[model samples]
Target chain A: EPEVTQTPSHQVTQMGQEVILRCVPISNHLYFYWYRQILGQKVEFLVSFYNNEISEKSEIFDDQFSVERPDGSNFTLKIRSTKLEDSAMYFCASRGDPSTNIREKLFFGSGTQLSVL
Target chain B: LAKTTQPISMDSYEGQEVNITCSHNNIATNDYITWYQQFPSQGPRFIIQGYKTKVTNEVASLFIPADRKSSTLSLPRVSLSDTAVYYCLVGGLIKAAGNKLTFGGGTRVLVKP
Candidate 1:
C-alpha cells in the first residue's frame, strides 16, 4: 500500500523562528490534509488543500500558517514564526476519490514531531 | 461537521470482543461514520467506515443503525497489540473542494493479557 511521507522526522527549533514541514502525499490522491496532536491531547485538524490551493482551514490555522503543494507532489506546511504552543506531532494525510460508491479513506504519514524551545 | 461522542476509555482482556459506540445525533444525510486507530507516536489509521447497515473489513466491523445517528466499532478477540486510541469521525461526501473530517476525543482501549 502507498503511504504518505513526511520529511524531517524530528524538528527542533527555537521559538520565534520559522519552520517549514514537508510532506509527499500518496500518488493519485485528490485531497490533502494536515493535523496536529499536542501531547496528551486529542488530534486537531489544521487545514486541507486541494487543486493546489487551500480549500478549508480550522480556527487553529492562523496568519502564521500556510500550505502549498509546490511541484505537484510535495505538500508543505510553513509556520512563519514558531511559538512554544506549536510543539506537537504534525501529520499529513491524503485521500482517494471521494465518490460515495467507493469506501474512501485518508492515508496518513508517520508524522513529523516538531518541538519549539 | 457533526460532533461525535464516545467513551473515554475501556478495559478488555485478550480473547474478548470489544465494542466501542459513538453517537452523532446531528449527523447529516450525506455524512459517513468512520473510525481510526492511533498507537503511541503514530498517525491515525483507518479502521472502518459505513453509511448505514453493517460493513465489515479485514480489520474490524462497523455497525450503523437505520437512523444513521450512531455507529459502533467491534473488534473480535482483541489482543494486547490492539491497545490504542480509537477515534470516531463524521464527515464525508460533502459537495465542495474538499471534505474535511472532524475528529473528537477518541476512546482509549487497553487490552490486558
Candidate 2:
C-alpha cells in the first residue's frame, strides 16, 4: 500500500528559529492536511490544502504557520518563529476522492518529532 | 463538529476480543464515524469508517446503531502488539477544501500476555 512519507523524522531547533516540515503525500491523493499533537494531548488540526490553496485552518494555525505545495507531490508546513510550546509531533495526512461510498480514509505518515528548546 | 466521548483506557489479555465504544450525541446527518489507531510517537492510522449500520473490514468492525449517536470498534483476537491508542472522530466528508478533521481523546488499549 502506498503511504505518506515525512522527512527529517526528528528536528531540534532553538527558540525564534524557522523550521519547515516536509511531506510527500500519496501520489494519487488530492486532499492534504497537517496536524500536531502536544505530548499527552489530543491531535489538533493545523491546516488543509487542496487545489494549491489552503481550504481550512484552525486557530492554532496562526501567523507564524504556513503551508505550501511547492510541487505536485510535496506538501510543507513552515513555522517562522518557534517557541517552547511548539514542541510536538507533526503529522502529514492525505485522502483520495471524497465520495460517500468510498469513505476516503485519511492516510497518515509516521510523523516528525519537532523539539523546540 | 460533533464531540466524541470514549473511555480513557482499557486492558485486555492476549487472544481476547476488544471493543471500544465512542459516543457522539450530536452527530450530524452528513457526519461519519471514523476510527484511527496510534502507537507510541506515531501518527494516527485509519482503521475503519462507517456512516450507519455495521461496516467490517480486515482490521476491525464498526457498529453504528440506527440512531447513529454511538459507534463501537471491535478488534477480534487481539495480541500484545494491538496495544495502542484508538481515536474516534466524527466529521463530514471532505468535499471542499475547508473541511478539517477533529480528533477526540482516544482510548488507550493495552493487551497483555
For each candidate, what TM-score against the reference? 0.96, 0.96
List chain A TM-scores, every candidate, in order: 0.95, 0.96
Candidate 2: Cα lDDT at A113:
95
lDDT of 2 by residue, A49-109 (tens): 8899998899999999999999889999999889999999999999887764656478899
Give the Å error, residue B89, model 2. Answer: 1.0
Sort candidate 2 into its docking category.
Answer: medium
For model 1, the stretches where C-alpha displacement exceeds 4 angstroms are A100-104
RMSD of 1: 1.3
Please give the C-alpha DockQ score of model 1.
0.69
Q: Candidate 2, residues B73-106: lDDT per residue as tens digits? A: 9999999999999999998766766467788889
